[model samples]
Target: MADKLKVALAIALVVAGVVGFYLLSEQALVLRVLSVLAGVAAAAAVASQSESGRRFVGFARESVTETKKVVWPSRKETVQTTGMVFAFVVVMAIFLWLTDKSLEWVMYDLILGWK
Candidate 1:
């Protein structure tokens, strides 16, 4: 029940911020943007108090840690992979074009004799 309440409050805070931004239309752009940011920050703080929020935060941290451990491909490997993909695409395009023209020729010049 408390967690639900926290979530609801956080949502309300976000809505209030958006409303504030529109209501302060006469204000400067920076102030209006700040209003929205403040609302979002407050909502985050409120939501982070909930049980599920804590779990989400923990999961996010774990994701970041796991990402750090990943062995990403080097620049050379990336470029090579990209080049291979482009080559394959070009080859496939040429093959498809040839097949299409061949079919068109056979259908019009041979079978139907429309030419």
Candidate 2:
């Protein structure tokens, strides 16, 4: 029940921030943006107190840790893979164009005698 209330309060905070932005439309762009940011920051702080929020924070932290552990492809491997993909795309494009032109020739010139 308390967690639900906290979530609701967080949502309210976000909505209030949005309203504040609109209300401050005549103000400077930076100030309007700051209003929204402040609201969002307040909401985040409030939501972080909830159980589900805590779990989400933990999950986010774990995701960051896992990402750090990943062995990313080297620059050379990346370049080679990109080059192969580009080569394949160019070959496929030429093949498709040839097939299309052949079909058009057969349909118009040979079969229908329209060309």
RMSD of 2: 1.4
Best by TM-score: 1
For candidate 1, write residues 10-97 as lDDT tens digits: 9999999999999999999999999999999999999999998999999999999999999999999999999999999999999999
Candidate 2 pairs with clashing backbones: none
Q: Given candidate 2, what's the lDDT at residue 83? A: 100
Model 1: which ten-residue window has the lowest total lDDT?
Answer: 51-60
- What TM-score does model 2 achieve against the real structure? 0.90
Clashes of each: 0, 0
Segments of candidate 1 deviating more than 4 angstroms = none
Local accuracy by lDDT, each model: 0.97, 0.98
lDDT of 2 by residue, 1-115 (tens): 9999999999999999999999999999999999999999999999999999999999999999999999999999999999999999999999999999999999999999997
